[model samples]
Target: MTEHLTIVDHPLVQHKLTHMREKTTSTAGFRRLLREISNLLAYEVTRELPVTTREIETPMNTMQAPVLDGKKLVLVSILRAGNGLLDGVLELIPSARVGFVGLYRDEETLQPVQYYFKVPQELEDRLVIAVDPMLATGNSSVAAIDLLKKAGATNIRFMCLLAAPEGVARMKEAHPDVPIVTASLDERLNEDGYIVPGLGDAGDRMFGTK
Candidate 1:
């Protein structure tokens, strides 16, 4: 887990995250906060992106400055709740290509079944970031990554709003190469599989559902 986990501790991220955690936050408020926090998280996540020096002229001088190198980034949202994070990340990188993975758990078997998935044309050539609000059992997260890998994504990173210890360990064991950026690593999941002290189901809160 040492190599896989990178917890963001920026004050703005933490402050917005705190508002996202409050139970009284309305659907509109939750959506807005998630978007704001996601932008902050996206900033940290893309901080180390490869940059190439290019000549640029300022009002007073011409100098070489860094610019993003290689192909445009690809953002793969892990459905419903992932869209919430996606919205904010897009605000920062509006030109990034977008993809979607739709997975739903079968209550009886407790397994993830993919219903939809679409990725960019050349996945292997681009940096891919998979977004999801909660890393719960890690089943769906792992499954989503499997799909992306099958589609030729070699460089991948996982971004989430909140995560649990079990899920973090599971993701590390399943996909050690994919680093995870999260707001907070909370206590263990409750019996019902929700992260203890978590804000609640991100999809429900974001959409005024449930």
Candidate 2:
């Protein structure tokens, strides 16, 4: 993903996103849509992955089959909300390694505070994709990427269900090398730092916490 930001506007993605944004969608329904949409987004994110051919014998004949080059992917979920996207992506790349970064926002300051951190080994040798549901303030996403870099992740990508312009700009300024893939880039953040037109609190909606 060379582009700094890629918005997946596939008809299926947009259709499901509309259902997800509806306030009346049930927790079960919301969760289902997220998984489906994540599968599609994962396709877009991995579209440019390098591939090399290997000799393989098919039932009909021998042929060179294309396969991903390099180590299995490493997916690091920015805990809580990130878990929502994790399951769906894993379904697409089951062999990929998994990790977690737990950070909660300080309500008053709107800053991310690290509570837990763990990741797969050889991060620098493999591509690391960080999953988060909503990129509202960007503070949390930026901080999460910071930790990933410190842990030796040179190549990284950010994936989200929705993103705010503020969040995209923030990530670009902080980590321009890392690409962003999102379902929608909604309007500016509201007064409370939530995406104005975003599905309200992805984690809450998916988990039925609120």
For every model shown, the clashing-pair count is 0, 0
Angstrom error at residue 120, model 1: 0.5
Cα lDDT, all candidates: 0.92, 0.94
Instruction: Estimate TM-scores for all models.
Output: 0.96, 0.98
lDDT of 1 by residue, 68-174 (tens): 99999999999889999999999999999999999986766657899999889899999999999999888899999999999999999999999999899989899
Question: Pick by lDDT: which candidate is best?
Answer: 2
lDDT of 2 at 192: 85
The residue-by-residue lDDT of candidate 2 on 14-89, one tens digit each, is 9999999999999999999999999999998888878899999999999999999999989999999899899999
**What ranges in model 1 sit over 4 Å off?**
none
